[model samples]
Target: MRWSAAALAAGQILVGGPVAAAPTVVIIALLAVVGLGVAVADRRLNTAVAWRQVSAVLMAVDLLATLGLVLAGLLQGNDELWVLLVLVVLAAALRYRIRGALAVALGAGLANGLLELLVNGGEPGPVIVGRLLVLLVVGGFAGSIARELDVERRLYQRMAEASQDIVAKRDEDAILGALARHVKDALDGSRATVHRYTLAGWEEVQLPDVLSVGSADGGPPLLTDEEGGVSATLHRLTWQQGSGRQPNRLTLPIRLPERPAEYVVAVEVTGPRPSALAEGALLALAESSAVSLATRDLIRHQEASNRRLERLEALRTRFVATVAHDLRSPLTTVKGVARILRGRREQVAPEQVDAMLASVERQANRLNRLADDLLDAARLDSDALELKLTDVAIDDILRSVVDDAGDEVELLGTPGLVVEADGPRLERVVWNLVTNALKYGRPPVHLCAETDGDQLTISVRDHGRGLGPEQVENLFQDFAGSGDPDSVGLGLAIVWELVEAHGGRVEYRPADPGADFVISIPRERTPGGSDR
Candidate 1:
């Protein structure tokens, strides 16, 4: 705008015969030189205030140049130079849309009319009015087109920046939040929110209903009930709660991998409807956001797999250390006790010989338990473990396991309780729980059995402090679940697998200042021989 307006007057003065109007031509030449210099030297103003000031100065330069050319044309009796008035109107229009253009048009018309009226006063009023009308139309039409072009350019630029922000995050929540904020700001909206759609809708899932779906037959399907768009809502654009005025809804359908239902983001506004450019910018942002969401899923999955691998490696290292120490220590004790009995049978007292034998028996039992755990774990891994379900007295199993744990244990059994379960496998489950409590916990272990509706539950609790939350999380994994030196690395894992085979689940309970483990199975669920 600045250079072109200036150059036109400068070019005409140089090429055309312009010596007739000396002062007016000099003014035109000076304005041309100044406008060209300013255009070349200027930088883009950063603030709104600076832009407005620069805009005013440039508009002033254009207006003066146009006026100078008009006056020069009049003084020289040349009709062609005044045609530059349209450039003045267009410059204003590009700077400040429609109204600015109209104002400049009025100024151009006045200059032409007044110049003609003074220079040739007998010129008809009708011709002057017609010239003014034509100038006004030119200003309006040109301004409108330029304004539309600037709007489109700004919209696309903002969308590109917004897309970058929305996808920069590597997590799901952050991506959703960025997309909502960009949409809200783009539409000049009051609020925006993410809406997720399932068979059950809205607040139950912690979002506002922006759109609702009912079966065309008025059934309950949400996503499939769509005419062309998904059923969901967010912000004030609620479909179910119609108030005094209807709010507009813009839904972005985001499909997360492996999720059962459709995910949606919605935008709402209490203001005027968004312009076409804003809507286009918004849709482009949504497309970018969907791709970012998929990327987030991939990134998170990769991170989880990495953590799992690290955990497995750590557990493997720990399991190796435990097996060496635990198996080797017991074997050494058994060998030493046997050597003592054989080497000094006569020298050792009868009581000393009996004590040595008892010591050997205890070490043998320790080695047997460790071997049993490894064997059970291997059977579980290969899915070769079987359950032989039969009617068994729950009280008897509880009593037997508690007795095996010695005098430090107590049984609080419901005497009449019975369950259809694999009697030996159920006993093994109880034995492992009792032994785990004793190894990792204090004395006075409590064993109890109770009927819970159609299920039977056995609970073993110890007086020692409970396990930490982190320990509880990996409590069923091979090698990772053991916290004690002699959890044997596979004791609890075997318990979990054996219980699961009986259609049961093992759970950890947080007793006050103690650790409690519970095993529960449906008493009526009798599947046998590994077939079911």
Candidate 2:
């Protein structure tokens, strides 16, 4: 019945006589008040003592109230009625498990029976006796059912909690250990082992042994021929009997899904056969545990792969640095010889001199540029490029870069754009951009700069075919140039690296007739701590 004040008042009026009803009413009212108070105080009852003690006190008070009703001759002394009291006592006993509930049941039964006999002047009628017997039977049956249900509920709760714990764990060993213990506990076995099959052979994992169960000494030999590779099977095995030894035999081989019979589970048990439900539950848990284990293993492998890739990249950067260093001296010597030959061109045969000097200078300059590019790439890859910070007019840097290009490309931009950054690196960035525009793009490449608030943006727009989405996505990556093989792919990568070193970023877009590269740098206050 739904519990409320009205229900309690009605129940008291029906069971208790008019003379005794007032006290009962007052007690019920007090209990209702106390219950509400307890509910309010529950938030503070975080400690175990409060939970256990408060509940015990409440149950005791309820039992005592029932006893008082019997004493006052207010309650009917029918068997069915008494049986209901016993059931209540049982429920209270189960929840609180206090010694008082037992006393209440026994004492109330004897006292109420005696009171009924005294008031009625003798033994009650057959109807009353039958009601008493029915009460006893019903109470006992209800109590038994409640106990069994509680056990089942607890078991299900434990399984759910265990599954949650397993899923939350990332460590492979801990997950396996917990899974093995869960299997062993559920199956009532001394041990449970998990064997994983590989390309070479079956590898036995001593999961149960790790959980401190059976001796890791010996077990049924797991071979490739075992049930044709770990299919679903159960086998009974008897240990070799020795002197002074009892026959230590047990049922083995509970196969999990996705694993071959080669993945054997040897459960040590004293019984002849495990229950059907237990066997099924054990197999299911094992299968799920295996999947979790496999997922964790894959994650571990991926982490290892990432570590190796990082190491390889570091080695490549070092190799590039070393090669650039080695080539610098030879390149310098070759350039020096070319310059000397060019100086002496007039003294030599006119035709051969011009051509020879020109060829020599061109090859030497190409070699020098290759060496510089390699060195720059290495520095960029290792993040070792240092910037010399300064406050410089953006127009000056643009003019310098354009002049260095020697009329190879046209430049267009506002004359007075200013920014606070590493002047040399910024110049290099602009030079690389303009050179790239001339080398890969059609003529009349345009340069522009703009400023807003605390940021300045410079753009180089080319008058050639625009880049596709794929090229734009990978434009800043090393060796990611498009078009002819004659073009070295490190120019834009260097530009991106230098700009980033200055705390700036580079972006690419389709210029109406070609491609546009834009660099945006934050305009910080000068080192004197004053905003520009």
Candidate 3:
């Protein structure tokens, strides 16, 4: 406004050059100085009261300056400075509505009228009255336009605020409740609800009242009735009572078509029905809420999947490192012994040759066992493993495995116990348990077997430090238990699978000084013998 006013003042001076009115130049300069000062002050303070007062004072100064120019006979017809009066009225209209515009119009018109009257010795005339009327008409029209624009601005602001609130909540419950309340407040409804259909039934969330009644017993069936078309889904329903009571209900679908689950936002209005504009705003809010919920669920699922992948990747890395180390140690030993025999065969004694050959054989066996474990894991993945089933003596397999392990293993319980299983798989399971005990446990590993009810119980107890905190349930997960580089951690996993295939279960019994692993297989009946 200041810049435009300055341009008008410059134009007035250019047109009045021959007339060289010093008084007109002085008035225009004063107007510019006051306007600029007030504008700068308002920017610095930025207070409502200060700007209002400044606006009023600025309008007054423009009015007085225009009147002085007219009285001096310098601002002639179509002088361009006349346009400054209209600008002042328009600026006031936007800020202060009709009343502000009227004030500007009256101040300018009355100043002109009084100056004319003073020149005419206080006589009323049609020219003064006609100009005043024109000013009033212009003020009224501009004010009306500003009022309409203010309404649209407010409506959009309200919607924007509600959207910001929805985004700020992290959890599902807060989002639903906030969306419901915003809709109710926007449409001037008495109560609002957000209903969702789950496996159990419909759940309703509302302000001041939250309920989760089943679909069968819930009072209103509007949500469960399954509205078909778009209009049926997002339309209004009216309920009337005998006592001249009526209420308006609005429903909008939260999700789009072909959704796995159904959701609706319902509102109840006790007063006049909402206008079409209000309904549109409410529907937009519901659609936004639906998209938000879908996005939140997607992010959560992705995070869970990423965590699982990270865990598997860590396990895979550990498995590779362990296998490489286990294989390399035996290979290194075998390579050293073979080099000794090949290079120094003539000088080495006969007895030393035998000892070196035995060492090579033991290391080769270790490498072979490692290879077998990897092969078993690959077969397990492809489901190509089959068991050779037969009736086996459990006590015989356990005793034989303990003896072959070459450790101070104590065998407890009677012999001659039999069960239905693959002999080689059962023996392998016992060998795995015994190897684990010898590697990780202290001395005095105990192997026990007994008949219990309809099953035979075989247990291996190791008198060593029990399992670590991370080694409990994950002991059977592939490459999961011990942190030892020599142990590939696949023995226990294979043992678990073979036992489960034989209709048996493997369990860990916690003990004070060590850990006990128990395997129970259903007792087998012989041709001429009763159930064991």
Best by TM-score: 1
Query: How many clashes show up in model 2?
Result: 7
Candidate 2 TM-score to native: 0.47
Arrange candidates by lDDT, descending: 1, 3, 2
- Once fitted onto the true fold, the runs of candidate 2 whose alpha carbons sit more than 4 angstroms away are 1-20, 26-54, 67-87, 93-108, 125-174, 198-203, 206-208, 215-217, 221-266, 269-295, 298-302, 305-309, 312-316, 319-334, 345-532
lDDT of 3 by residue, 175-229 (tens): 7778777766765766666776667766665434422322233345233322321
Write model 2 residue lDDT over 176-292, tens digit each, in one string: 677666755654666555555557865677554443576566545322222344322433221222123322223233234544433444444444454344444455555566566
Model 2 pairs in collision: 79-131, 79-132, 229-261, 230-260, 230-261, 230-262, 231-261
Clash pairs, model 1 backbone: 209-233, 210-233, 210-234, 211-232, 211-233
Candidate 1 ranges beyond 4 A from true positions = 1-28, 40-51, 70-78, 118-121, 146-194, 200-249, 252-261, 265-273, 287-314, 337-372, 378-431, 441-489, 504-532
Q: What C-alpha lDDT, on a 0 to 100 scale, does residue 485 get in candidate 1?
A: 48
TM-score of each: 0.66, 0.47, 0.59
Candidate 2 at 254: error in angstroms?
Answer: 13
lDDT, residue 175, candidate 3: 75
